[model samples]
Target chain A: MSWARPLVLGRLVRLAWLLPLAAVGLFTLISLAPIDPVQAYVGDRTALVGSDQRAAIAAAWGLDRPATERFGAWLGGVAQGDLGRSITYDAPVSEVIARRVPASLALIGTAFVTSFVVGTGLGIAAATARGGVGDRILRSLAVVLSASPGFWIAILLIAVFAIALGWLPSCCAAPPGLTLAEVGIGDRLRHLVLPVATLSVVGTAPLILHTRQRLVVFLDGPAAQHLRAHGLTERRIAFGAGLRHAVGPALNLHLAGAGELFGGSVLAETVFAWPGLGQATARAATGADAPLLMGIGLSTLLLVFCGNLAADIAARIADPRLRHPRP
Target chain B: MTLRARDVGLSFAHPGTHPDHAPTRALEGISFDVAPGEVLGIAGSSGAGKSLIAAALAGILPPAALLDGGITLNGTPPSPRDIALAPQRLDALDPLATLGRQIRRLGGRRTDPAALLARVGLTARVARAYPHSLSGGMARRALLATALAGGAAWVVVDEPTVGLDPEAADRVMALLRALAEEGRGLVVISHDLPRLARIATRVLVLQDGRAVETAPAAAFAGDGTGLATAFARRLWQAQIEDPAC
Candidate 1:
């Protein structure tokens, strides 16, 4: 080929099914949930409402239609950028998400960056130093944290920082005060501290493990052995060839783990009462707001799809072997 | 400068020795010398110490191995500046780099990828390709380029023709001959005795990690009668007896 093909186009084509498949799965599971959004919307008046009134409400909401029809209609509305109105917020689902996007962006973005930097750094250090005390400690810590659930860590942090020490608020994104822009950096940072930490503490473990594993393969493998025989210092060969070879696999694992990280955002956001899609998702579920729940589910699935695409593109950029479609 | 191994012996930790970790000898009574312009071939069967000796000469023996006798490149201990080893594996090529980029990196101050590829019997077009895209012969030559990148005076090539076709193997052997002609000491470890004999000035026979016989390449002649030891002769006899095997 005289001109190099756009690998991203090929990657996207390969990955195009991820979003639709995940949407179907999410819609199916949500539909199967035993939530009575109509009954929840009616509240205490369920006792007083006549059967005809109830039937009218159900039919109006298209709940009287077959599940396949309802899902199809909802999916069609989603394609038109209408995520339906929230029964709980008494507003458009998009508006509720819009009001909360900044909080999610600020929190998840910080978590995403912090987890990668710290995790990869620790992993490199541990691998290079192999049997050192630091590696031993970090490896054990990674094992424990990888298995630890997100909410458990959040609750633990709350117990220590908020209850026992009384140093920070137990919940909520910020103290009841002026808007976020008006709040000083110190106040904003304090509000950010717990949730970001909660996500990071649990999130960084898999990255560290994956990076270390890849580094070991690169450093200890036959290729490394061959490099050493070429009269270069161990440190130079390791930093040069080792890092270059390890980056592709390590980044792949990191990206794969990143998709699932959104799940943790839900627990982290709820624990701190941060007004993100995470917390909104929980509240929607609790209120049995089917439309709002579906909207949040779709958004989270889209984020995962984007993350996977980003990783594939990133891999292509970093390594030429991944650039072209495999023959 | 001559590369010499004087009664070189290596041992490794063995719990069989008792409560105290005593080393068990893996290689013993190994000795040889290769001068500039000489191609010294080492031959051995499976589980013999051929690759280990290659690694030791390049100062890359496993950490558990302990050395008794010294190895000297130009009367100093073996170091990367004077010695290089091209191992069997080609996957060691950095997958992230283009052939030219990797060649340049390995070449250090000798940074002309086009020149290096030409020297290794490859065209400049080969430089633009990734390691995986290169054919088996091209990859081997590229690795040879990497091994010679630092311009080491002595090169140890372990199983350089392991997976090559006859034509590619001939090309690699010819390249080794050309390098030897350039006055660099070369050591080749291989099971292919006929190929080694075609280029090697002298061949060192090894069995069970010990030097069995040191013979001029011409001595591996008809019926193996010219060989110095029965073990070396028997090995040749086996190959001659069962050429299909």
Candidate 2:
């Protein structure tokens, strides 16, 4: 099939509709909240401020305008490369987030790869050893971990490794370095250990469950038995024959969970004090920094959409069954 | 080489049963043999252990299946060099790969795919097609090609003619007959008796997991003249009763 035309059309349509609608959604959420943007910006008690002062602060922040006008202005400003000003930082929201994207991606990227490899490997092992003790153990562990919250795991890691064992740092992504470059790779990696562990633990569950379930269906079927009869080893039959079938579903489950993984990431980042977008978003929410919150929301949404696209491309590339057009 | 399964017994735990439940025997006292250059057809109704015997011979019995005896080729269990099975399910071929790569996976790095395809009555164009793209006959040929590439002494084919038209079935059986002519033993499992009678040197009748009777292919003729057992005669009688078979 010729995909070029549909691809261009899809890109144009999504850009035309999704960006504005998403912005409106975020703006509506922030505006409808009971908290005052003036009090949020001031970060102080309302009892200490005079009526004249509140009016001035509200006017300066455009909180005095109609909802439609404020959304239009915010969208226009964003289109012009201004993501509005951060009430908490007194800096442009984009600039604050720009400094944090690399850290968030690095943390998420490492955890993503680690969780994918370990979870998929364990799932394959469990599937091949179906009805065995190892399969039961891995399955039970995944069930328990899938239900466990990421923040709770983050706290447990800190209690055990950071505080109890005194083996690792508890926070701040590298001891509050003047610049990330100033911190040695060793220090960066050390700080990465806890956050990555927390994220990977939470991320691994869905992957394991999906892979195990999908793989068992494939491996226990006639195809696998046929492969065995042809002198293929169990590993060859499992990985070569079985993994090829298992990968598409597992990739879907993993990528589908990418959004939720990042959603839970904020808690891990906050508990560990990791200087990532998740922690930044958490702070933005608490401080009522609408601009920062909007910036993170759009960025996370974009990441999730991209993840979905990756899953689509991967499904086509990995399975010839999908590459052909269905009638 | 001679592939033989002697007094083979297999049992499976009844479905939805606890560990304490008695295992139901799916195959019992099943005995058969196929010599090189011979075509042996095992015939039975559905759930009659024909597939179970094939599974046992293929060394693919599941964990739940208990076996009392074993299969051997030339008095030893078939080695990687001894046998391969062409399964009924087309999915036996990896969907992710072209048919050529799978044949090569068995035949090794330097093997020419065109030659393998040619050996199985497939065109070189088929080498590039994925498993799902191939027609039923094409999928059956691909399985046959895989088995041939393994250089095994025997090939066990399960229900090769199940979904094929008459022309396609004849094409598949012709291919099997040719493989036997090349001195490779064949064990074919199917209920298509009339067709099996054409090529099989001997046929084994399985009922309730037991081999009730074994007879020469001639026994499957109109009235089952050479059939020794009443069960075998009834099976042959049913086919005789239905001309469509």
Candidate 3:
């Protein structure tokens, strides 16, 4: 547990630098886009607005300023705990993010937990049956699922369960034009099913493949042999000694893959029209909502940093060698 | 009852990583026996298949290795649990487990971890340490202790004293000797022929995975005069005259 202290402090230091760097990077990338923020905000009314009105709008939003000046203003506001405002939504960036974060968390949290549990189980099964039919089938499934794009799978699920069978809604976190107060719990969960399943399938693939690969090596290693020699059955050795040995590497692999999982969630959100940070990010990127994008970018960097740190702490708990220095 | 490897042979697939590979013979025509209260020492230079023989005896051969003939106890194939192998590689110990927990797991709930560690000349504190925290010598002793704790009828120990200081090495040899004296069969594999000769009832010398000689321990006498094979004589002489000695 002592390892957690230094590990967390070190990550916090890295994160302090990462948040600003990510904000600047997102601001720069979004700035390079051809879409005009005022044009996006006004939509088809862009032609109706006169040059005078456009100039007033650009001045009001500070879009008329130099990129460096706008970035400096944004950074200064962030240092003072202000996240600026979303030009697209006509709301504070922080407020928009707060409203959307729970939706994203519900989606990513359910999907990620499912992926971890199911992927780890499948991986253990495959490794325990390495070179057998079950191993081959699981490995093949992992390959196909991992290689396919997340949105593609989302569309496929929508096609089968939503459009084809009409078993579930095709898209969106709630029925069109419905407020949170109007939607029932069952309806909300019904709307969630496809996207969560899609993200879970996408996230689970790499975990299964990685866990199986790492665990197979461990199952064939000296520790497994030692366990076998001690009179334990194969099943006992695989679940007992082999699982403990392989889990640390598998967890680290999963955490190292946080970037991909985040990227996949974005794709899933766009396809399913989920009202989450990912969907907001997509809309913000296209609408040239610099402030909103900056807020989301910083939040994402923070989430990923926290996730990796949590994984490090968990792995140390699993393997004591990681907790103490080699004597 | 005795532990026996009768005409036992082992061949691992070459280019082991590949699906299509040829079997490369590692050990063949290897035969020996260790009855209760007897110690059989297996000695050879590096790459002589000494460890392979130990793996064969313990029934922990790699999946790629094709084993021929048989290793038996009391005239039948023994269950894997009946043989305890303390592998040469320190990595064989469960890295995630404390020495005490692993001892309890292998030795059963009733077996006292501290008592077992003390028997191997380790402190009770050592039982609480993870494998990686131990020195190489400590790891080796810990491994031996775990093997002993298994309480297997047949114990196969590979290079049990490779990293130990002289005194610790002697202590390990004595502990193994005591096990044999207590009517447990042991197959002690080592490059330290001299130390092995001290306790081994019979020493089987291996060359390129084949047994070159199986002689009574007393045969490794002055100037290696009693050693039967010329190769065995030179091997004995070389160890005796080595600069390390």
Candidate 4:
């Protein structure tokens, strides 16, 4: 029973090489683009410039060297925790990302937890009431939500909740002069309502459907019958037995979906004017700020990698069949 | 403790468009008693509800099947914890869990499983193996160990030696006899007349969900006057009559 070896080793090897390769490739392509950084800063590509000025600018940014030499310097800087300074922001790329990363991480983390809890609970309820009105209604809701595009759903929610109802501010406001710890739970929840709800509602459908399908299949298995025959309480059997068996596939999907949430949050931040990585990326992309763009891309890659890694570990923990193989 | 089923009947609801879709009776007016420390062997042809009786004694009848009469163990209805049943199919064991864990789950103790497995002629090494890693006989023995692990007052073993070599069957029957001598009631359900005679003290004959005869194990040994002989004679006559034995 030693199945975990090949799986862990294969994933580790891919992560060690493929991720660095992807990051290097992205850095190269963005650096070699035909756009001029000075013109991008000046907002006029045809603006006349002296050769000495261009040479000084190229030397200052280390772009005067060959592409290989430049990439090597950049890679070495990355290895030394320097990530280089953003030409547009005039600050360290790491510092800019560090300040905004927490906000985006908080938003996506809350959304992931909210979606997982609500979706799995609804799925179990629907499964227990299968072929009944509850199941039908749940199925209809899941299908509708799953088919609706996330951007459209986010717009619809904003229009109804923010514009029509006027319950909360439509965009980011001042933090109300409260420390992060001093912010009342209710007040924080009120502020987070739109973003968290939007993210969770858009992400919940697949999780709900997967959980319901897996639970129904598990209920039909021999282990379920064995538990029933053991005189375990129905509630215990449903949650303890049913959920334990169903958690593996549900978790894998949920974790994969959690990684996609970062991408969704980028769009969502742009739409809602939320101060997060997506907004920062949009600002950088609009200005063709290569350093800032690279920083955001690398940050997003890290988030996605961490999400998937957590998911793999959770799946292994949930499924003994995966952790141990027959000898 | 004694187990008694008084005129027990089980019927299944038939699904159809017809208005008069009465329930199909699987067992009808079946009455029998398994005394303490005695082995009662039930013999019947296929579809005679022999296994249903085992299920009833274990209090695990299917949801669709309705019980008509009472089934009492030790003068009370049987509870899941009090009775153990070994199903005919070895696939009932979970393929994912180790054999030791499955047995421990049933008994809720570690010591009993190893002892029970040893009693059923299984080695200590086999206890750690999965069901797929076991041979057919070893799987059956593991299943029996699981049944006996709970110190069940009565064990309803359904076709314990159905697909085993003669040596394995002897080992299983010897284990059952030993359990019976320890003052636990044993109900052995099988179609093998001679094997049942070897382990069973009393034999009960079932036909079409009805008990036709009850006699001592020796009654079927000499003359064909006992239930086993009568069951075989009925089968032979039915084959001669319909050619579908």
In CAPRI terms, where does candidate 3 land?
medium
Using DockQ, give the best candidate's number: 3
* Lowest lDDT block of 10, candidate 2 chain B: B73-82
Candidate 1 wrongly placed segments (more than 4 Å): A1-28, A38-76, A163-170, A318-327, B15-22, B237-245
Interface RMSD of each: 1.6, 1.6, 1.4, 2.8
Write down the DockQ of candidate 4.
Answer: 0.29
| Residue-by-residue lDDT tens digits, candidate 4, A39-97 | 66656534576667777876887767787786787778888888878877778989988
Question: Which pairs clash in the backbone of model 2?
Answer: none
For each candidate, give the TM-score of chain B. 0.93, 0.93, 0.93, 0.90
Q: For candidate 2 chain A, which ten residues in a row score worst on lDDT?
A: A1-10
Q: lDDT by residue for model 2 over B40-113, one digit each (tens)?
A: 99998888988777777777878778988868776877775577888878878877788888888877778788
| Minimal lDDT window, size 10, model 4 chain B | B236-245
In the range B1-245, model 4's lDDT, one tens digit per residue, is 57888888998876554758888888888787887789998887888889989877776677677888988886788888777888787876766567787777777755556677888888887777777778888888888887877778788888988888878788778888888998988899987666777889987778888887776777665445443456755643443355221
Model 1 lDDT per residue over A145-213, tens place = 888888888889899998899887766666776677777778888888889888887668877887788
TM-score of chain A of each: 0.86, 0.93, 0.94, 0.84
- Model 1 residue A83 lDDT? 86
Better of 1 and 4 by lDDT: 1
Question: What are the Cα lDDT values of the candidates?
Answer: 0.81, 0.83, 0.86, 0.76
